[model samples]
Target: MTYLPLPQPRTTPVRVMTIAGSDSGGGAGIQADMRTFALLGVHGLVAVTAVTVQNSMGVKGFHEIPLDVIAGQIDAVASDIGVQAAKTGMLASSAIIDTVAGAWRQQGLAGAVPLVVDPVCASMHGDPLLHPSALNSLKEQLFPLATVVTPNLDEVRLIVDVEVVDDASQRDAARALHALGPQWVLVKGGHLRTSSRAPDLLFDGTEFREFDAPRIDTGHDHGAGDTLAAAVASALAHGYTVPDAVAFGKRWVTECLRAAYPLGQGHGPVSALFRLNE
Candidate 1:
């Protein structure tokens, strides 16, 4: 006898928005953030700030989106579609950074919703991704609004002027960044050459916590930072606390890094495709 099939209820995922640049390479920026969000069981939204012309090799150039449009995108999503958590990346100018920060305040997501700020100023290959004039604006206008700011060693140097030569210095850098007013700051140690096993340091106003992803020895780690930040935002949307979310993010990006593969003439992107099965 043939049994009749019953329909199951359609489910909606928690939404996590990425306010960043559009990577034509499909490796980093908005592409990486969205890919990471979806792989982690969350709905992905975007408010693209720039259109970058680049590939695995490096960023060639980028064009910023209009200020009004950038803010409108955030407002549109926050008003009707809704966002559970959000992130910022590759805001190439002071004006754009200010626009994004103001949009978050207007939408009431500045402190109310978890925001992961990835202070992306350059590519791994040393290609500039941010304008020289915008650095001060990023630190002043955006950092305070973040729930967690994830900065790699280079960004650590750029942000706090502390060269993280060792674990102790990593703590110092996190302490410095925490003073910038983010609720928490994660100092990523992936670029540390002094140690074989690089660990990340998280500092709140009170104490410190550490997270270490199993090091995957691969150069095709183009989107690792974006992936980590996006994963943190996704976990936040799932109602995880800041520390737990960062822990989950570190674990997730480690897997992505492990599965990274070359795509072009240069470094490829860290892949969340592996998580599709998990």
Candidate 2:
């Protein structure tokens, strides 16, 4: 007897998109994000803004993608397949940031999508990834659209001119940055005030949620920020609440860093697929 037709898939996979650069080091940027999404059971898409020549040690060189090309990439993914959640990282220039912000505005993705903005200025190995001129555009254009802005202590100073090295400073910095318009702001305190513990402050306009973890003393964290931001976006795309998503994201990054493998001569990358083996 002939078999009946098979049923179609019940639902589309949660789609998370990363608009960032390509790191040849395979640690940070879009590559890390994709891996995070995959490990989290979400679909990952990318619109790379630049090509970075980097290793664990430091960045050697970077080539910016043309503004038109960036725009085209955004349009192609956003129009056809579409994205449920997305994040921005390593937009090399003001023009590139302007282009992406304009595209998002034009696409009217403001409230329709959950957006994470990881203002990636400097690399982990003390290399600058974003141009100084682009900082203004990021604050004026992109910050307002972000559902969550994940900035390390240094990046917080770069954006809002506020110090976030201590608990008190982190609170004030979160408030000041929330004023700039992100619905939620997370000031990561893993680097600064690095004494014994790692504390992160998440300010949701009205309240503050602090997450602390015992700092894993290791240099094998190449894509910690990218991985965290991407994991948050992935969780949000899968319909998790902001607080829960951030918590899970933080835990995920910690585990990745803990299980990081020694690769190149410098700091290696956090394993985005840690959950897969768990």
Candidate 3:
């Protein structure tokens, strides 16, 4: 009998986790994160905090997952599979935020796992994803623990209570958010109507760097924020520095947006698998 060589142990891929909601439309939240992780060659794990009924048109409704269950999911993944980095999105309420924060501390993941926080306050279609009452808790409990916080203009306005109407105000917003204790703050300026270039500012308390990409004239960027944050976390899991990871994420998101395709009626999702075709 021919003896086959014993199968060698498979090398484990870099692992990342996303603590976020579930988009039934599969455009954002856990679905988008998983897709971005896969595209970046990382093993994706998830702890879903909410399940949203949404489509391209808008968010119809949502239901938050139980606090214990959310904690259990994190514990199971971190204790066994092991997470190198993680990202949070669409944490609907203060209870969910507190639970996630407690899990991060109790699991001893603080300072060990790089966390990218996407303060998802509203949907792309202008529907509220987070409760207004939960905003303070999210800032107080989760922002300090974040390695980096990615917030769009609207989210920045909500967090810093400032009007980000122009580039100057956008920079101010970035600084304000950086003051909240995140090691870095990325204020997405895609909504700035005054500029032709889509510029995002990164503030690390002492320095400010801008990443500019040509603005794509398209309405298919429904999951762009989720995609960018997940890609950054995946890069972090692969040992990239925070700045480098954000740069890579920006390029990746730009490409995804460039290759976006129409799906549902209103707005479609950026193509997370765009690289595959290249």
Candidate 4:
């Protein structure tokens, strides 16, 4: 029997892994993460934590992957293909969080790989993604292991009990989240009316730097969060420093937002299709 020919050698040295739920709508989750990774020039690997059923309307339901299966996927990739960086989204439960955290520690990837933890709490439509009981596990188990924790205003309130209203409060909120032990915490000000531009605060336990973009007046930005976190992961995989990675992410997601499009009955998704232009 004839065997298939071996593929050519890879020129890409950077591999970024996304540990996330599947979005059937293709607007967010792993779908969005993959798009961001590819556009940013990295090989994307996945460890699906859950499968979500939803559209622009909202998340109707979701089925989490089995604990062992989730852990196995992570191990499978780490031991063989090997990722340079990893990011997480939509960890469905406390048990899943513990399992993923355990796998990270066991693989000695906790402080090794640059881990971008997007503490996804709710959807843009205000639907819950993580279970209430999982919050503590996320903070206690995952945050300490993260290179950065990117929390939007809503997640900032949920995770650290700080309501970000203005610039000073945004700074305060970033400080509160830093205490949880991530090397850096990015407090997203996308939803905050603190300024005319979309301002985001990055805190490295001590210093605070703000990154902002021209706030494109639009409502069709469903995948913005996933895109930002994924872009950061991609940058990290390509050897950018944490601050520089985040800076690249901010610029990338801003372009994505500018290209946002309408989808269904509710809000649509941001676009990375803009990269086609560049």
The residue-by-residue lDDT of candidate 4 on 32-115, one tens digit each, is 999877766678899999999999999999999999999999999999989899999999899999999999999889888999
Candidate 3 weakest ten by summed lDDT: 1-10
lDDT of each: 0.88, 0.87, 0.89, 0.90
Better of 1 and 2 by TM-score: 1
Compose the digit string of candidate 3's lDDT tens values, residues 183-269: 999999888878999899998999889998999999899899999999889888878888888888998888889988887788899
* Predicted candidate 1 versus true structure: per-residue lDDT over 1-278, tens digit per residue: 11112223477778889999999999999999988876666789999999999998888988989999999999999999999999888999999999999999998887789999999999888988888899899999999999999999998898889999987888889889999989999999889876777698889988899888556899899989999999889888888899988888888888888889899999999998985554
Runs of candidate 2 with Cα error greater than 4 angstroms are 1-11
Q: At residue 77, give the lDDT of candidate 3.
A: 94
For this target, which candidate reaches the highest lDDT against the unseen true structure? 4
**Pairs with steric clashes in candidate 3:** none
Cα RMSD, each candidate:
4.8, 5.3, 5.5, 5.5
TM-score of candidate 1 to 2 decimals: 0.95
lDDT per residue, candidate 2, 52-157, as tens digits?
A: 9988788999999999999898888899998899998899899999999998888878888999999999998778988899898998999999999999988988
Whole-model lDDT, model 1: 0.88
Predicted structure 2: lDDT? 0.87
User: Which pairs of residues have clashing backbones in candidate 2?
Assistant: none
Task: Please provide TM-scores, in order, for all candidate models, with all chains considered together.
Answer: 0.95, 0.94, 0.95, 0.95
